[model samples]
Target: MSSQRSSKTFLQLKYGEALDTAATKKSITSLLSSHDGTEVIHHCLKEGARWGMSPDSEEPNTLEAVYILSGKLKLHRPNEGSFLEAGDFLAGQPVSEFIVLTALEDSEFLYITSNPVFHYYSSDTRNLEMLAIEIEKKDGYTADHCFRIKELSMLVGEKMELNSESLQKLHFGALLHDIGKTEVPESILLKPAKLDEEEWTIMKEHTRYGATILRKTNITHFILAAEVVEQHHERYDGSGYPKGLRRDEICLEAAIVGLVDSYDAMTSERIYSKARSKESALTEIKQLRGIKYHPEVVDYFLSVIE
Candidate 1:
Protein backbone atom coordinates (compact mmCIF):
# COMPACT_ATOMS: atom_id res chain seq x y z
CA MET A 1 0.00 0.00 0.00
CA SER A 2 1.14 3.61 -0.57
CA SER A 3 2.82 5.28 2.38
CA GLN A 4 0.02 7.86 2.77
CA ARG A 5 -2.61 5.12 2.76
CA SER A 6 -0.59 2.98 5.16
CA SER A 7 -0.29 5.91 7.59
CA LYS A 8 -4.04 6.56 7.41
CA THR A 9 -4.79 2.88 7.92
CA PHE A 10 -2.45 2.69 10.90
CA LEU A 11 -4.26 5.62 12.53
CA GLN A 12 -7.65 4.07 11.77
CA LEU A 13 -6.69 0.66 13.21
CA LYS A 14 -5.07 2.24 16.23
CA TYR A 15 -8.13 4.36 16.98
CA GLY A 16 -10.36 1.40 16.04
CA GLU A 17 -11.40 0.73 12.43
CA ALA A 18 -15.01 0.85 13.54
CA LEU A 19 -14.62 4.46 14.72
CA ASP A 20 -15.85 7.33 12.51
CA THR A 21 -12.57 8.66 10.97
CA ALA A 22 -14.41 11.49 9.26
CA ALA A 23 -15.83 12.71 12.57
CA THR A 24 -12.42 12.49 14.20
CA LYS A 25 -10.84 14.44 11.32
CA LYS A 26 -13.63 17.02 11.52
CA SER A 27 -12.99 17.58 15.21
CA ILE A 28 -9.26 18.04 14.61
CA THR A 29 -9.89 20.48 11.79
CA SER A 30 -12.30 22.43 13.97
CA LEU A 31 -9.69 22.79 16.70
CA LEU A 32 -7.09 24.12 14.25
CA SER A 33 -9.67 26.40 12.65
CA SER A 34 -9.95 28.31 15.92
CA HIS A 35 -7.15 30.63 14.73
CA ASP A 36 -9.07 31.82 11.69
CA GLY A 37 -9.40 35.60 11.21
CA THR A 38 -7.63 36.39 14.50
CA GLU A 39 -4.24 38.07 15.09
CA VAL A 40 -2.85 34.96 16.72
CA ILE A 41 -1.71 32.27 14.29
CA HIS A 42 -0.27 28.87 15.22
CA HIS A 43 2.91 27.89 13.38
CA CYS A 44 6.45 27.70 14.68
CA LEU A 45 9.30 29.08 12.57
CA LYS A 46 12.66 29.30 14.30
CA GLU A 47 15.40 31.92 14.07
CA GLY A 48 17.89 31.93 11.14
CA ALA A 49 15.54 29.77 9.10
CA ARG A 50 15.22 31.00 5.53
CA TRP A 51 12.75 30.23 2.75
CA GLY A 52 11.81 31.93 -0.51
CA MET A 53 11.54 31.51 -4.26
CA SER A 54 14.54 32.22 -6.51
CA PRO A 55 15.20 35.57 -8.27
CA ASP A 56 13.60 34.37 -11.47
CA SER A 57 10.78 32.74 -9.58
CA GLU A 58 7.38 33.60 -11.06
CA GLU A 59 5.34 34.79 -8.08
CA PRO A 60 1.62 34.37 -7.88
CA ASN A 61 -0.78 37.28 -7.60
CA THR A 62 -2.47 36.60 -4.33
CA LEU A 63 -4.16 38.30 -1.42
CA GLU A 64 -2.08 37.44 1.60
CA ALA A 65 -2.51 38.20 5.29
CA VAL A 66 0.13 37.67 7.97
CA TYR A 67 -0.26 38.15 11.70
CA ILE A 68 2.58 37.65 14.12
CA LEU A 69 1.56 35.59 17.13
CA SER A 70 4.81 35.59 19.10
CA GLY A 71 8.47 36.42 18.50
CA LYS A 72 9.40 38.03 15.17
CA LEU A 73 9.86 37.54 11.43
CA LYS A 74 11.88 39.55 8.96
CA LEU A 75 10.28 39.64 5.51
CA HIS A 76 12.70 40.70 2.81
CA ARG A 77 11.87 42.11 -0.60
CA PRO A 78 14.25 43.22 -3.35
CA ASN A 79 14.64 46.74 -1.95
CA GLU A 80 12.75 46.74 1.32
CA GLY A 81 12.08 44.58 4.35
CA SER A 82 10.47 44.78 7.77
CA PHE A 83 10.55 43.08 11.15
CA LEU A 84 7.14 42.10 12.39
CA GLU A 85 6.46 41.34 16.05
CA ALA A 86 3.57 39.90 17.96
CA GLY A 87 0.22 41.51 17.09
CA ASP A 88 1.61 43.04 13.91
CA PHE A 89 -0.22 42.45 10.63
CA LEU A 90 0.95 42.78 7.05
CA ALA A 91 -1.46 42.64 4.12
CA GLY A 92 0.19 43.53 0.83
CA GLN A 93 1.77 42.21 -2.35
CA PRO A 94 4.93 40.20 -2.44
CA VAL A 95 7.93 42.14 -3.64
CA SER A 96 9.72 41.71 -7.01
CA GLU A 97 7.67 38.68 -7.92
CA PHE A 98 9.60 36.95 -5.12
CA ILE A 99 9.84 37.16 -1.35
CA VAL A 100 11.94 35.81 1.47
CA LEU A 101 11.15 35.22 5.14
CA THR A 102 13.64 34.73 7.96
CA ALA A 103 12.58 34.15 11.51
CA LEU A 104 14.23 36.53 13.96
CA GLU A 105 13.35 34.24 16.83
CA ASP A 106 11.27 31.21 17.55
CA SER A 107 8.15 32.81 16.14
CA GLU A 108 4.52 31.87 15.65
CA PHE A 109 2.41 33.29 12.87
CA LEU A 110 -0.82 32.86 10.95
CA TYR A 111 -0.41 33.16 7.23
CA ILE A 112 -3.27 32.83 4.74
CA THR A 113 -3.21 32.92 0.97
CA SER A 114 -5.68 32.49 -1.86
CA ASN A 115 -3.31 31.52 -4.68
CA PRO A 116 -2.91 27.95 -5.77
CA VAL A 117 0.27 28.62 -7.74
CA PHE A 118 2.76 28.22 -4.88
CA HIS A 119 2.15 25.55 -2.30
CA TYR A 120 4.14 26.29 0.81
CA TYR A 121 2.52 25.22 4.06
CA SER A 122 4.12 27.95 6.15
CA SER A 123 2.08 30.56 7.98
CA ASP A 124 0.69 32.18 10.90
CA THR A 125 -9.43 39.31 17.56
CA ARG A 126 -11.40 39.35 19.99
CA ASN A 127 -13.87 41.93 21.31
CA LEU A 128 -13.28 44.80 23.81
CA GLU A 129 -12.82 42.46 26.75
CA MET A 130 -9.92 40.86 24.92
CA LEU A 131 -8.79 44.20 23.50
CA ALA A 132 -8.45 45.65 26.97
CA ILE A 133 -6.24 42.79 28.00
CA GLU A 134 -4.15 43.13 24.84
CA ILE A 135 -3.68 46.86 25.28
CA GLU A 136 -2.74 46.45 28.91
CA LYS A 137 -0.05 44.03 27.90
CA LYS A 138 1.17 46.32 25.14
CA ASP A 139 1.29 49.62 27.07
CA GLY A 140 -1.08 49.99 29.95
CA TYR A 141 -0.68 53.64 30.93
CA THR A 142 -0.59 54.94 27.37
CA ALA A 143 -3.57 52.82 26.42
CA ASP A 144 -5.69 54.16 29.24
CA HIS A 145 -4.55 57.74 28.63
CA CYS A 146 -5.33 57.40 24.96
CA PHE A 147 -8.87 56.22 25.66
CA ARG A 148 -9.49 59.37 27.68
CA ILE A 149 -7.81 61.66 25.14
CA LYS A 150 -9.78 60.15 22.28
CA GLU A 151 -13.03 61.18 23.90
CA LEU A 152 -11.82 64.73 24.44
CA SER A 153 -10.23 65.02 21.01
CA MET A 154 -13.40 63.73 19.38
CA LEU A 155 -15.44 66.46 21.00
CA VAL A 156 -13.10 69.12 19.63
CA GLY A 157 -12.62 67.45 16.26
CA GLU A 158 -16.34 67.03 15.70
CA LYS A 159 -16.95 70.70 16.47
CA MET A 160 -14.49 71.46 13.66
CA GLU A 161 -16.64 69.34 11.29
CA LEU A 162 -13.72 67.08 10.47
CA ASN A 163 -14.68 64.11 8.31
CA SER A 164 -15.35 60.89 10.15
CA GLU A 165 -11.98 59.42 9.18
CA SER A 166 -10.06 62.57 10.14
CA LEU A 167 -11.93 62.73 13.41
CA GLN A 168 -10.97 59.16 14.12
CA LYS A 169 -7.35 59.91 13.29
CA LEU A 170 -7.38 62.93 15.58
CA HIS A 171 -8.84 60.90 18.39
CA PHE A 172 -6.20 58.23 18.06
CA GLY A 173 -3.40 60.70 17.48
CA ALA A 174 -4.11 62.55 20.70
CA LEU A 175 -3.92 59.35 22.70
CA LEU A 176 -0.63 58.27 21.16
CA HIS A 177 1.15 61.62 20.91
CA ASP A 178 3.22 61.07 24.03
CA ILE A 179 3.94 57.41 23.50
CA GLY A 180 7.53 58.19 22.60
CA LYS A 181 8.14 59.28 26.16
CA THR A 182 8.46 55.63 26.98
CA GLU A 183 12.02 55.71 25.71
CA VAL A 184 13.06 58.76 27.72
CA PRO A 185 15.20 58.22 30.79
CA GLU A 186 13.04 57.63 33.83
CA SER A 187 15.16 59.92 35.99
CA ILE A 188 14.80 62.75 33.53
CA LEU A 189 11.17 62.05 32.96
CA LEU A 190 10.29 62.06 36.64
CA LYS A 191 12.82 64.61 37.84
CA PRO A 192 11.44 66.87 40.52
CA ALA A 193 13.82 69.73 39.89
CA LYS A 194 13.85 72.01 36.86
CA LEU A 195 15.67 70.42 33.96
CA ASP A 196 18.97 71.99 33.09
CA GLU A 197 19.45 73.19 29.53
CA GLU A 198 21.12 69.91 28.59
CA GLU A 199 18.37 67.90 30.24
CA TRP A 200 15.75 70.02 28.52
CA THR A 201 17.41 69.42 25.16
CA ILE A 202 17.35 65.72 25.76
CA MET A 203 13.74 65.90 26.83
CA LYS A 204 12.81 67.73 23.63
CA GLU A 205 14.15 64.86 21.57
CA HIS A 206 11.28 62.69 22.82
CA THR A 207 9.13 63.99 19.95
CA ARG A 208 11.58 62.87 17.31
CA TYR A 209 12.24 59.69 19.21
CA GLY A 210 8.52 59.01 19.37
CA ALA A 211 8.14 59.45 15.63
CA THR A 212 11.12 57.17 14.98
CA ILE A 213 9.84 54.40 17.25
CA LEU A 214 6.40 54.36 15.65
CA ARG A 215 7.97 54.45 12.20
CA LYS A 216 9.49 51.04 12.88
CA THR A 217 6.08 49.46 13.44
CA ASN A 218 3.51 48.23 10.91
CA ILE A 219 0.94 50.59 12.37
CA THR A 220 0.80 53.07 9.49
CA HIS A 221 -2.56 54.18 10.77
CA PHE A 222 -0.69 55.88 13.62
CA ILE A 223 1.48 58.01 11.34
CA LEU A 224 -0.48 61.13 12.15
CA ALA A 225 -0.26 60.28 15.80
CA ALA A 226 3.49 60.08 15.39
CA GLU A 227 3.54 63.43 13.64
CA VAL A 228 1.56 64.94 16.49
CA VAL A 229 4.17 63.65 18.90
CA GLU A 230 6.92 65.23 16.84
CA GLN A 231 5.23 68.57 16.53
CA HIS A 232 3.16 69.03 19.68
CA HIS A 233 5.83 71.21 21.22
CA GLU A 234 5.92 73.64 18.34
CA ARG A 235 4.53 77.13 18.90
CA TYR A 236 1.99 79.03 16.87
CA ASP A 237 4.33 81.92 16.08
CA GLY A 238 7.39 79.68 15.47
CA SER A 239 9.38 78.44 18.48
CA GLY A 240 8.96 74.67 18.46
CA TYR A 241 11.34 71.84 17.81
CA PRO A 242 12.62 69.43 16.28
CA LYS A 243 10.86 71.63 13.80
CA GLY A 244 9.79 75.20 14.44
CA LEU A 245 6.60 74.84 12.42
CA ARG A 246 4.45 77.94 12.65
CA ARG A 247 0.76 78.62 12.22
CA ASP A 248 -0.69 76.47 9.44
CA GLU A 249 2.73 74.95 8.88
CA ILE A 250 1.93 72.58 11.75
CA CYS A 251 -0.58 69.75 11.37
CA LEU A 252 -3.93 70.59 12.94
CA GLU A 253 -3.73 67.34 14.83
CA ALA A 254 -0.46 68.40 16.42
CA ALA A 255 -1.98 71.73 17.37
CA ILE A 256 -4.89 69.99 19.07
CA VAL A 257 -2.58 67.70 21.03
CA GLY A 258 -0.42 70.62 22.08
CA LEU A 259 -3.43 72.46 23.42
CA VAL A 260 -4.76 69.51 25.33
CA ASP A 261 -1.33 68.43 26.49
CA SER A 262 -0.66 71.83 27.99
CA TYR A 263 -4.00 71.76 29.74
CA ASP A 264 -3.33 68.36 31.20
CA ALA A 265 0.21 69.26 32.26
CA MET A 266 -0.97 72.38 34.04
CA THR A 267 -3.88 70.67 35.78
CA SER A 268 -1.97 67.55 36.81
CA GLU A 269 0.56 67.68 39.62
CA ARG A 270 4.15 67.06 38.70
CA ILE A 271 7.06 66.45 41.03
CA TYR A 272 8.46 69.87 40.18
CA SER A 273 5.22 71.73 40.05
CA LYS A 274 1.97 71.54 41.95
CA ALA A 275 -1.18 71.24 39.88
CA ARG A 276 -2.63 74.60 39.10
CA SER A 277 -6.27 75.37 39.74
CA LYS A 278 -8.47 74.76 36.74
CA GLU A 279 -9.39 78.43 36.54
CA SER A 280 -5.73 79.44 36.66
CA ALA A 281 -4.76 76.93 34.02
CA LEU A 282 -7.56 78.13 31.76
CA THR A 283 -6.43 81.73 32.24
CA GLU A 284 -2.82 80.86 31.36
CA ILE A 285 -3.88 79.02 28.19
CA LYS A 286 -6.07 81.94 27.19
CA GLN A 287 -3.17 84.37 27.65
CA LEU A 288 -1.04 82.34 25.24
CA ARG A 289 -3.84 81.85 22.68
CA GLY A 290 -2.66 83.89 19.74
CA ILE A 291 1.06 83.79 20.57
CA LYS A 292 1.87 80.25 21.69
CA TYR A 293 -1.23 78.49 20.42
CA HIS A 294 -3.41 78.59 17.34
CA PRO A 295 -6.35 80.93 17.88
CA GLU A 296 -8.97 78.46 16.68
CA VAL A 297 -7.55 75.64 18.80
CA VAL A 298 -7.52 77.84 21.87
CA ASP A 299 -11.10 78.86 21.16
CA TYR A 300 -12.24 75.24 20.89
CA PHE A 301 -10.40 74.24 24.07
CA LEU A 302 -11.94 77.13 25.95
CA SER A 303 -15.39 76.16 24.79
CA VAL A 304 -14.82 72.56 25.92
CA ILE A 305 -13.59 73.59 29.34
CA GLU A 306 -16.52 75.96 29.80
Candidate 2:
Protein backbone atom coordinates (compact mmCIF):
# COMPACT_ATOMS: atom_id res chain seq x y z
CA MET A 1 0.00 0.00 0.00
CA SER A 2 1.32 3.42 -0.89
CA SER A 3 1.25 6.04 1.87
CA GLN A 4 2.07 8.88 -0.50
CA ARG A 5 0.06 12.06 -0.15
CA SER A 6 -1.61 13.86 -3.01
CA SER A 7 -1.65 17.62 -3.22
CA LYS A 8 -4.85 17.38 -5.26
CA THR A 9 -8.21 18.10 -3.68
CA PHE A 10 -9.28 14.50 -3.94
CA LEU A 11 -7.75 11.04 -4.03
CA GLN A 12 -9.39 7.87 -5.21
CA LEU A 13 -8.72 4.49 -3.69
CA LYS A 14 -9.48 1.41 -5.72
CA TYR A 15 -10.83 -1.87 -4.39
CA GLY A 16 -8.52 -3.49 -1.80
CA GLU A 17 -6.15 -0.53 -1.99
CA ALA A 18 -4.83 0.89 1.25
CA LEU A 19 -2.85 4.02 1.96
CA ASP A 20 -0.77 2.28 4.62
CA THR A 21 -0.83 -1.07 6.38
CA ALA A 22 0.01 -2.71 9.71
CA ALA A 23 -0.74 -6.02 11.41
CA THR A 24 0.14 -8.88 13.70
CA LYS A 25 -2.24 -11.75 13.01
CA LYS A 26 -5.10 -9.30 12.42
CA SER A 27 -4.44 -6.15 10.41
CA ILE A 28 -5.19 -2.45 10.18
CA THR A 29 -4.73 -0.46 7.01
CA SER A 30 -4.87 3.28 6.94
CA LEU A 31 -7.17 4.34 4.15
CA LEU A 32 -6.95 8.05 4.79
CA SER A 33 -5.49 10.45 7.35
CA SER A 34 -5.60 14.18 8.02
CA HIS A 35 -3.11 16.59 9.55
CA ASP A 36 -5.63 17.38 12.26
CA GLY A 37 -5.30 13.76 13.52
CA THR A 38 -8.40 12.27 11.96
CA GLU A 39 -8.04 8.90 10.27
CA VAL A 40 -10.13 6.42 8.34
CA ILE A 41 -8.72 2.92 8.80
CA HIS A 42 -9.68 -0.53 7.66
CA HIS A 43 -9.41 -3.05 10.44
CA CYS A 44 -9.50 -6.86 10.22
CA LEU A 45 -9.77 -9.06 13.24
CA LYS A 46 -9.73 -12.81 13.61
CA GLU A 47 -12.61 -14.42 15.42
CA GLY A 48 -12.13 -14.17 19.19
CA ALA A 49 -9.55 -11.44 18.81
CA ARG A 50 -9.91 -8.26 20.86
CA TRP A 51 -9.13 -4.60 20.34
CA GLY A 52 -9.20 -1.88 22.99
CA MET A 53 -9.74 1.86 22.68
CA SER A 54 -9.40 4.51 25.34
CA PRO A 55 -8.87 8.25 25.46
CA ASP A 56 -5.46 8.87 26.89
CA SER A 57 -3.82 12.17 27.78
CA GLU A 58 -2.01 12.27 24.46
CA GLU A 59 -5.24 12.13 22.53
CA PRO A 60 -8.00 12.91 25.00
CA ASN A 61 -11.32 14.05 23.57
CA THR A 62 -10.81 11.63 20.73
CA LEU A 63 -14.01 10.50 19.12
CA GLU A 64 -14.42 7.26 17.19
CA ALA A 65 -16.93 5.38 15.08
CA VAL A 66 -16.96 1.78 13.96
CA TYR A 67 -18.79 0.66 10.88
CA ILE A 68 -18.86 -3.06 10.74
CA LEU A 69 -18.07 -4.44 7.32
CA SER A 70 -18.81 -8.10 8.08
CA GLY A 71 -19.13 -10.72 10.82
CA LYS A 72 -20.11 -10.09 14.42
CA LEU A 73 -18.54 -8.01 17.16
CA LYS A 74 -19.32 -7.22 20.77
CA LEU A 75 -18.66 -3.94 22.50
CA HIS A 76 -17.84 -4.22 26.20
CA ARG A 77 -17.77 -1.42 28.70
CA PRO A 78 -17.93 -1.49 32.47
CA ASN A 79 -21.34 -3.04 33.04
CA GLU A 80 -22.97 -3.18 29.66
CA GLY A 81 -22.35 -5.03 26.39
CA SER A 82 -23.76 -4.59 22.93
CA PHE A 83 -23.49 -6.63 19.80
CA LEU A 84 -22.92 -5.29 16.28
CA GLU A 85 -23.38 -7.05 12.99
CA ALA A 86 -22.72 -6.18 9.40
CA GLY A 87 -23.98 -2.70 8.47
CA ASP A 88 -24.13 -1.72 12.10
CA PHE A 89 -22.47 1.52 13.20
CA LEU A 90 -21.33 2.53 16.65
CA ALA A 91 -19.87 5.87 17.63
CA GLY A 92 -18.95 7.65 20.80
CA GLN A 93 -17.01 10.57 22.14
CA PRO A 94 -14.03 10.18 24.45
CA VAL A 95 -14.72 9.00 27.95
CA SER A 96 -12.61 8.44 31.02
CA GLU A 97 -13.08 4.67 30.63
CA PHE A 98 -12.10 2.09 28.06
CA ILE A 99 -14.19 0.27 25.51
CA VAL A 100 -13.21 -3.13 24.16
CA LEU A 101 -14.35 -4.79 20.99
CA THR A 102 -14.29 -8.53 20.61
CA ALA A 103 -14.75 -10.18 17.24
CA LEU A 104 -17.47 -12.76 17.57
CA GLU A 105 -16.42 -14.02 14.19
CA ASP A 106 -13.80 -13.13 11.63
CA SER A 107 -14.66 -9.45 11.21
CA GLU A 108 -13.71 -6.36 9.28
CA PHE A 109 -14.65 -2.76 9.89
CA LEU A 110 -13.91 0.83 9.01
CA TYR A 111 -12.56 2.60 12.08
CA ILE A 112 -12.74 6.35 11.94
CA THR A 113 -11.16 8.31 14.75
CA SER A 114 -10.82 12.04 15.40
CA ASN A 115 -7.45 11.59 17.07
CA PRO A 116 -4.47 9.88 15.43
CA VAL A 117 -3.70 6.25 16.31
CA PHE A 118 -2.24 5.22 12.97
CA HIS A 119 1.35 5.61 14.09
CA TYR A 120 0.89 3.54 17.24
CA TYR A 121 -1.05 0.83 15.47
CA SER A 122 1.19 0.91 12.41
CA SER A 123 4.64 1.33 13.93
CA ASP A 124 5.03 0.52 17.61
CA THR A 125 2.28 -2.06 17.87
CA ARG A 126 3.20 -3.67 14.55
CA ASN A 127 6.83 -3.90 15.61
CA LEU A 128 5.85 -5.69 18.79
CA GLU A 129 3.62 -8.09 16.93
CA MET A 130 6.40 -8.88 14.50
CA LEU A 131 8.66 -9.53 17.45
CA ALA A 132 6.11 -12.03 18.72
CA ILE A 133 6.25 -13.84 15.42
CA GLU A 134 10.01 -13.91 15.62
CA ILE A 135 9.81 -15.56 19.00
CA GLU A 136 7.45 -18.22 17.71
CA LYS A 137 9.79 -19.01 14.85
CA LYS A 138 12.79 -19.03 17.18
CA ASP A 139 11.19 -21.68 19.39
CA GLY A 140 8.82 -24.04 17.68
CA TYR A 141 6.94 -24.96 20.84
CA THR A 142 6.10 -21.33 21.50
CA ALA A 143 3.53 -21.09 18.76
CA ASP A 144 0.73 -18.85 20.05
CA HIS A 145 2.09 -19.17 23.58
CA CYS A 146 2.37 -15.41 24.05
CA PHE A 147 -1.02 -14.90 22.46
CA ARG A 148 -2.62 -17.45 24.80
CA ILE A 149 -1.00 -15.75 27.75
CA LYS A 150 -2.43 -12.47 26.56
CA GLU A 151 -5.93 -13.85 26.29
CA LEU A 152 -5.84 -15.64 29.63
CA SER A 153 -4.19 -12.70 31.31
CA MET A 154 -6.88 -10.41 30.00
CA LEU A 155 -9.51 -12.73 31.41
CA VAL A 156 -7.81 -12.51 34.77
CA GLY A 157 -7.49 -8.75 34.48
CA GLU A 158 -11.14 -8.43 33.69
CA LYS A 159 -12.00 -10.73 36.56
CA MET A 160 -9.91 -8.62 38.90
CA GLU A 161 -11.83 -5.53 37.80
CA LEU A 162 -8.66 -3.68 36.87
CA ASN A 163 -9.08 -0.19 35.46
CA SER A 164 -8.83 0.64 31.78
CA GLU A 165 -5.16 1.63 31.69
CA SER A 166 -4.09 -1.39 33.72
CA LEU A 167 -5.95 -3.66 31.33
CA GLN A 168 -4.13 -2.10 28.37
CA LYS A 169 -0.78 -2.62 30.04
CA LEU A 170 -1.70 -6.18 30.88
CA HIS A 171 -2.80 -6.84 27.31
CA PHE A 172 0.40 -5.61 25.65
CA GLY A 173 2.69 -6.80 28.40
CA ALA A 174 1.44 -10.39 28.37
CA LEU A 175 1.95 -10.66 24.62
CA LEU A 176 5.52 -9.43 24.84
CA HIS A 177 6.61 -11.10 28.06
CA ASP A 178 8.70 -13.73 26.32
CA ILE A 179 10.03 -11.34 23.67
CA GLY A 180 13.39 -11.41 25.37
CA LYS A 181 13.87 -15.06 24.47
CA THR A 182 14.55 -13.80 20.96
CA GLU A 183 17.97 -12.78 22.19
CA VAL A 184 18.76 -16.26 23.52
CA PRO A 185 20.77 -18.59 21.32
CA GLU A 186 18.90 -21.24 19.34
CA SER A 187 21.00 -23.94 20.99
CA ILE A 188 19.51 -23.28 24.41
CA LEU A 189 16.06 -22.36 23.17
CA LEU A 190 15.69 -25.60 21.21
CA LYS A 191 17.62 -27.91 23.43
CA PRO A 192 15.57 -31.02 24.25
CA ALA A 193 17.22 -31.47 27.64
CA LYS A 194 17.30 -29.45 30.81
CA LEU A 195 19.50 -26.36 30.61
CA ASP A 196 22.66 -26.59 32.64
CA GLU A 197 23.29 -24.05 35.38
CA GLU A 198 25.07 -21.72 32.94
CA GLU A 199 22.42 -22.21 30.27
CA TRP A 200 19.76 -21.55 32.92
CA THR A 201 21.60 -18.37 33.84
CA ILE A 202 21.41 -17.26 30.20
CA MET A 203 17.72 -18.17 30.15
CA LYS A 204 17.01 -16.02 33.20
CA GLU A 205 18.38 -13.01 31.36
CA HIS A 206 15.41 -13.10 28.97
CA THR A 207 13.31 -11.15 31.48
CA ARG A 208 15.78 -8.29 31.41
CA TYR A 209 16.23 -8.72 27.69
CA GLY A 210 12.48 -8.51 27.21
CA ALA A 211 12.37 -5.33 29.28
CA THR A 212 15.17 -3.81 27.23
CA ILE A 213 13.44 -4.69 24.00
CA LEU A 214 10.17 -3.11 25.10
CA ARG A 215 11.85 0.02 26.54
CA LYS A 216 13.49 0.78 23.20
CA THR A 217 10.04 1.25 21.69
CA ASN A 218 9.60 4.33 23.93
CA ILE A 219 5.84 3.94 23.83
CA THR A 220 4.16 4.38 27.19
CA HIS A 221 2.12 1.20 26.95
CA PHE A 222 5.08 -0.95 26.00
CA ILE A 223 7.35 0.86 28.44
CA LEU A 224 4.96 -0.18 31.17
CA ALA A 225 4.91 -3.64 29.59
CA ALA A 226 8.67 -3.71 29.98
CA GLU A 227 8.22 -3.48 33.69
CA VAL A 228 5.86 -6.47 33.55
CA VAL A 229 8.26 -8.49 31.44
CA GLU A 230 11.15 -7.64 33.75
CA GLN A 231 9.30 -8.64 36.88
CA HIS A 232 7.14 -11.50 35.60
CA HIS A 233 9.81 -13.93 36.67
CA GLU A 234 9.96 -12.50 40.16
CA ARG A 235 8.23 -14.62 42.79
CA TYR A 236 5.66 -13.61 45.35
CA ASP A 237 7.86 -15.06 48.10
CA GLY A 238 11.08 -13.60 46.69
CA SER A 239 12.26 -17.00 45.44
CA GLY A 240 12.14 -16.14 41.72
CA TYR A 241 14.88 -14.67 39.54
CA PRO A 242 16.40 -11.49 38.06
CA LYS A 243 15.29 -9.20 40.89
CA GLY A 244 13.48 -11.66 43.17
CA LEU A 245 10.82 -9.03 43.82
CA ARG A 246 8.45 -10.25 46.53
CA ARG A 247 4.70 -9.76 46.86
CA ASP A 248 3.85 -6.07 46.45
CA GLU A 249 7.22 -5.39 44.90
CA ILE A 250 6.00 -7.00 41.68
CA CYS A 251 3.47 -4.95 39.75
CA LEU A 252 0.01 -6.43 39.56
CA GLU A 253 0.26 -6.66 35.79
CA ALA A 254 3.46 -8.67 36.07
CA ALA A 255 1.96 -10.83 38.74
CA ILE A 256 -0.96 -11.57 36.47
CA VAL A 257 1.30 -12.40 33.56
CA GLY A 258 3.60 -14.46 35.73
CA LEU A 259 0.76 -16.59 36.99
CA VAL A 260 -0.74 -17.07 33.53
CA ASP A 261 2.64 -17.71 31.98
CA SER A 262 3.38 -20.40 34.50
CA TYR A 263 0.03 -22.09 33.97
CA ASP A 264 0.43 -21.96 30.21
CA ALA A 265 3.90 -23.40 30.47
CA MET A 266 2.69 -26.27 32.60
CA THR A 267 -0.19 -27.07 30.31
CA SER A 268 1.91 -26.78 27.15
CA GLU A 269 4.02 -29.55 25.75
CA ARG A 270 7.67 -28.65 25.94
CA ILE A 271 10.96 -30.22 24.98
CA TYR A 272 11.70 -30.61 28.67
CA SER A 273 8.27 -31.29 30.10
CA LYS A 274 5.15 -33.05 28.98
CA ALA A 275 1.88 -31.18 28.92
CA ARG A 276 0.01 -31.29 32.21
CA SER A 277 -3.72 -31.60 32.48
CA LYS A 278 -5.72 -28.48 33.32
CA GLU A 279 -6.79 -29.99 36.62
CA SER A 280 -3.20 -30.86 37.43
CA ALA A 281 -1.93 -27.39 36.56
CA LEU A 282 -4.66 -25.80 38.62
CA THR A 283 -3.86 -27.98 41.57
CA GLU A 284 -0.22 -26.97 41.51
CA ILE A 285 -1.00 -23.30 41.02
CA LYS A 286 -3.52 -23.38 43.82
CA GLN A 287 -1.04 -24.99 46.15
CA LEU A 288 1.50 -22.23 45.70
CA ARG A 289 -1.08 -19.44 45.92
CA GLY A 290 0.69 -17.21 48.37
CA ILE A 291 4.17 -18.64 47.90
CA LYS A 292 4.74 -18.76 44.16
CA TYR A 293 1.89 -16.43 43.20
CA HIS A 294 0.10 -13.44 44.65
CA PRO A 295 -2.89 -14.44 46.79
CA GLU A 296 -5.26 -11.97 45.14
CA VAL A 297 -4.00 -12.82 41.67
CA VAL A 298 -4.49 -16.52 42.34
CA ASP A 299 -8.07 -15.99 43.44
CA TYR A 300 -8.99 -13.98 40.38
CA PHE A 301 -7.10 -16.33 38.06
CA LEU A 302 -8.92 -19.32 39.47
CA SER A 303 -12.20 -17.57 38.91
CA VAL A 304 -11.26 -16.79 35.31
CA ILE A 305 -10.12 -20.31 34.46
CA GLU A 306 -12.93 -22.02 36.27
Instruction: Find the candidate with the highest lDDT and give its number.
Output: 2
How does candidate 2 fare on TM-score?
0.72
lDDT of 2 at 68: 90
Per-residue accuracy of model 2 over 1-306 as CA lDDT, tens digit each: 002111000111111122123233453455665667788878777776666654444444567787899999877655556788999987766434555666778888887877655654545454566677567656655556766787799888877767655777788788778889989988998887878999999999999998999787655566667888899999999999898889899999999999998998889887667899999999999999999999999999998899
Return the TM-score for candidate 1, rounded to 2 decimals.
0.55
Q: Model 1, 166-223: lDDT tens per residue?
A: 5434644565566566676776776767889998888889789867765554232344
Prediction-by-prediction clash tally: 3, 0
RMSD from true fold, candidate 1: 17.2
List residue ranges in candidate 2 displaced over 4 A: 1-37, 42-49, 54-111, 114-120
Colliding pairs, model 1: 109-124, 110-124, 111-124
| Stretches > 4 Å off in candidate 1 | 1-146
What's model 1's lDDT at 118? 19
How many times do residue backbones clash in model 2? Answer: 0
lDDT, each prediction: 0.54, 0.72
Candidate 2: 10-residue stretch with minimal lDDT: 6-15
